[model samples]
Target: MAHITAGVATSHVPAIGAALDNGKAGEPYWQPVFAGYEASKRWIAEEKPDVVILVYNDHASAFSLELIPTFAIGCADEFQPADEGWGPRPVPVVKGHPALAWHLAEKLIQDDFDMTIVNRMDVDHGLTVPLSLLFGQPAEWPCQVIPLAVNVVQYPPPSGNRCYNLGKAIRRAVESFPEDLKVVVFGTGGMSHQLQGPRAGLINREFDNAFLDRLIDDPAGQAAVPHLDYVREAGSEGIELVMWLIMRGALDEKVTVAHRFYHVPASNTAVGHLVLENALG
Candidate 1:
């Protein structure tokens, strides 16, 4: 049966993607951010999973005002990089793990999670930035992906508890798949910063770090945090942190923190990255 080898959580700031694409990663301002992922890059190369269940949100790209999927899974053969105003970042097209994705969707629905199974999508930076951070500039992504797009753009996004429970359901789906595959689940986005209003440049390092500690040591308690707290304290966009609970819940009750990196001022955002491995079989 397929097993979840690990879970990764990271902030998916668009500026990070531009830094990598424009060859600015080596600059002092960007160096620290890139340094945060060096260990992750090497680790991924060594522990190459058969598939990655990338959990991220679309920034008004695929889903706009007309439609939004609370939870969407990509079962397409491949996804093209999205053109988010500035044009598509120079990156390899994402190849999807269709067989696994389809199986996951069916099982998730059967388990009572209403998921929109997408056959096509143009992946935005939320999905690609994390890949770039982990894989660097591979000519092609090293492994197949199953894009799990969560709707964090709209108000009333799925609650922290809901995401956490869905992750448990995902774990059941993954363990039941009768295939010899290794999977890694990634929860991407947020370390506290707001992108709009008078507080466009908010960064609460204390709050961000405190949240990380809770996520690692007491995720159930972290899941209890309300949306207003994330918005009011962390920043409006910081609500993205709720997605981390999904990755946390997918793992065994105990996990070993393999590597972690945190840095701030990444173009109006605080970047955080974590790598956790299941401590139990």
Candidate 2:
């Protein structure tokens, strides 16, 4: 059985990328924010995963407030980049691993995990920022992507436990894949802080570290944590931590945490990264 070799979690702040590359993102306050993705970049270079399963929530770009699916998988052949405020990045449309994606989509449905399969959709900075940080916008990226986009932008979002269960389903889907391949699973977004209203730039390192500790030592306990707790304490949009639970549930119990980093105020969000070796002996 093919196994997931590495797992990474990152925050996607479009302004951070913009400031890193163009030196100006209209927010002078966020310019010197130290491009918070160097570790993920180095990890990709070291591991060179064959396929990357990216779990990220769209910001009402692909799926609007009009309709939201609990969990959606991108089964498209290619995904064009969408413009948020500064416009889309100058990169080729993302190439998808349709064969694997389709198989996984069907398997998720078969496994009693309802998932929305999308054949045509454009990716926004949510999916593109990590790619650019880790792989840069070369003529082609080093690894193919299997996008698992969650509906986090809207209210009544999927529960934290719900996302965790999806990870378990994803593990079954990937391990059952017939091809000889190595995989990397990514759970993107959140640790603390909020982006809207009066609560913007709020950082809670205490809550963030507590969540990280539970994620490795006791994931079930972590999964049992309610979404309301995260929203109230970590901020409303910080509910995106639910996505991290998805990545956590996909891994085996014995995960060797090798490298970890956490920081705050990265474009009105808290950023963190974890590198876990699968099935630690």
Candidate 3:
């Protein structure tokens, strides 16, 4: 049967992609951020998961105001990189795990999570930056991906509890799949920073750090935190942190946190990355 080997959590700042694509990764401001993921990149190369279930939000790139599904799973065979105003980052197109994706989608629906099954969609930086951070600029991604897009853009995004429960359901679905495949779940976005109005450049390092600590040691308790706390304390956009719970929920109750990196001021967002291995996987 398939098994979930690990989970990764990170911020998906677009500037991080620009830094890598424009050859500014080694600059002092960006060096530390990239350094944070050096260990992860190496570890991922070694672990070589067969498939990655990436949890991220689409930033008005693929789904505009016209339609926004709270939870959507990509069941397509391939996905193109999206051009988010500036231009599409020079990243390889993402190949999907159709068999596994369809299996999970079917199970999730039966499990009572009304997920939108997307046959095709262009993935934005939220999905690709995490891959680049872990795999570098590969000619083709080493493993196939299953994009799980959550709606964090609109107000009243899934609550922390709901996201956590969804992750648990996903873990159940994966374990039941007949293939003996290895899978990794990634929860991407947020440390703390707002990107609108007068508070556009807000950064709450204290809150961000505390969040990391809780996420690492007390995820179940953290899952009970209300949405207002994330917006009011962490910053409006910091609500993205809720997505991290999904990744946390998919893991073994006791996980070894292999690596963690946190840095601030990445173009109005704090960058956080973590790699977790399931103890009993």
Candidate 4:
């Protein structure tokens, strides 16, 4: 049976993607952010998961006020990058694992989690940036990707507890699959930085670090964190961190911290990444 081997969580900052695409990653300001992921790139290359369930929010590129699915699973054969006013980043198209994706959608929905099944949708930086950060400039992504687009952009986004429980359900679903495959869950977005309003450039390092500590050591505690706390303490955008709980929930309750990286002021946003492997006997 298929099983989840690990979980990865990272911030999907758009500027980071732009820096890589525009050949600015080597600049002094961007070097540290890119450097932090060097070990991650190497580590993922070695683990080589067969399928990745990438959890990210659609930044109004694929869905706007007109429509928003709280949780949408892409079951298509491929996903094209969206033109976020910059004409789609010069990145390879995203190939999807329809079989596994459909399985997840079916099982998750049956598990009482309402999920929107998407046959087609253009993926935005929220999805691609994380891919670039970990996989680098590969002509094609190394493995099949299953886009699990969460709705963190709208009001009343799913609670952290809900996301975490969904992750648990995903693990159960994967374990039930007949194929002998390795799977990884990626939770992308957030490290406490608001894009607008009074706290336009907020970066609560203290809160961010504390959250990470709880995430690694006490995920259930982190999951219980109320939505208002994320908004008031981490900033509105910081709510994206809830997505990370889903990735955490997919893994063993006890996991080995394979790699952890955190940095500040990457495009006025905090960039955080974590690689967690299920503890082996």
Candidate 5:
């Protein structure tokens, strides 16, 4: 049966993608950020998961006020990158694993989690940037991707606890699948930094680091964190961290920290990344 081998948590800052695409990654300003992921790129290449369940928020590119599903799973064969006002990033199209995706949707819904099943949707930086950060500039992504979009752009986004529980359900679903496959669950977005309002450029390194520490050592405690705390301390967009709980919930109780990286001011946002494997793996 298929089993989850690891979980990754990252910040999907769009400017990081632009820097890579514009050939500025080697420039002094961006070198540190890119350097942090060097070990990650090497590690993922070695692990080589067959499928990745990428959890990210759609940044109004695929869905807006007109429609938002609290939790949506992409069951399509492929996903095109969105324009995001700059035309699609010059990246390869995203090939998806429809079979595994549909299985997750069915199992999650049956487990009492309401999920919107998407047959087609253009993926934006929220999804692609993480891919680039880990996989680099490959002509094509190394493995099949399954987009699991969570709605953090809107108010009343799912709680950390709910997302965490959803991750547990996903693990159960994956193990029951008949295929022998290695899967990695990616939780993307957040590490303090708001894009607008008085606190638009907010960056709380203390809070961000603390959150990461808790995420690795005490996930259930982190999952119980309330929304107001994230808004007040980490900034509004900081709520994106809740999505990380989902990735944590999918892993074993104890995990080996394969790699961890964090940096500040990537387009006025905090960039954080972690690679964790099942303790036994």
Candidate 6:
């Protein structure tokens, strides 16, 4: 089985990317955002994993209310850039791990999880922001990427438990693969901040901090938290916590915290980052 080298969680604040590339929004607050990812880049260079399974929620760019998939895996050879209001970030096209992705798709469906498999998909800032920050657009990406999109935009998205189950299935899929590879799973989006309506600007330090503590120590307890409570308390879009369950499930009961950082109110989003390393075999 391929070793899971690392896990990363980050908020995909668009302005952060813009600030780095064009000095467009390089506010005093945004400096920390870029500095926070410096270690991630260094770690990736040191570890140099072969595949990255990006767990991120789309912001109504590719998948929408017309067809809301609980969890969708990308099997495309290349993913295009989306026009995320500002524009594409001129990054290298995203590559897919077709052999592993397809095999995982088959096994997931057989295991009673219906995951949408897309041949064509365009990723938005939610996924790209972290990519650009962690691994800038070289002639090519540092590694092949398996884009995993979770639904956090539309109402009544997948439940927390369901996401946890999906993560378990993903672990099985990775373990079942025939070839040797190094895999890193990333769960992106939210420490807490709402972007729509009056409920926007809501920040829950208590809930967010409690979540970080529970995520490493008591995953099931964290996974069992009501998704609605996340919406009502953490902010509507803050329900993106479900994606983290996927990353958490891939990990063993015990993991060493490599690093962690947190900040608030970055363009109506709470920005945070964490790296988890599973117990050594």
In terms of lDDT, the poorest run of 10 residues in model 1 is 272-281
Candidate 5's residue-wise lDDT over 110-140, tens digit each?
9999999999999999999999999999999
Candidate 1 residues 183-276, lDDT tens each? 9999999989898899998999999999989889989899999999999888999999999999998998788999988887899888888999
- Give stretches of model 5 more than 4 Å off: none
Q: What is the lDDT of residue 251 in candidate 6?
A: 75
Q: Where is model 4 more than 4 Å wrong at Cα?
A: none
Candidate 6: tens digits of C-alpha lDDT, residues 98-144? 99889889999999988899999999887888788778657778888
How much does candidate 2 score in TM-score?
A: 0.92
Report the alpha-carbon TM-score of model 4 versus the true structure.
0.99
Candidate 6 wrongly placed segments (more than 4 Å):
24-27
Candidate 3, residue 203: how far the Cα is off, in Å: 1.1
Ranked by lDDT from best down, the candidates are 5, 4, 3, 1, 6, 2
In angstroms, the error of model 5 at 239 is 0.2
lDDT of 2 by residue, 1-281 (tens): 65688677777777656764574633556533344455556767888887888999887778886779888999988888887767777766788899889989999999998899999888887788777767765888778888899977777778877888888888899889999778888888787878778887788888998888888788888888887899888998778888988888788876988667776667677777787768631
**Residue 243 in candidate 5, Cα distance off native in Å:** 0.6
Per-residue error for 137 in candidate 1, Å, reads 0.3
Greater-TM-score candidate between 1 and 6: 1
Candidate topping lDDT: 5
Colliding residue pairs in candidate 6: none
| Model 3 lDDT, full chain set | 0.93
RMSD of model 4 against the true structure: 0.8
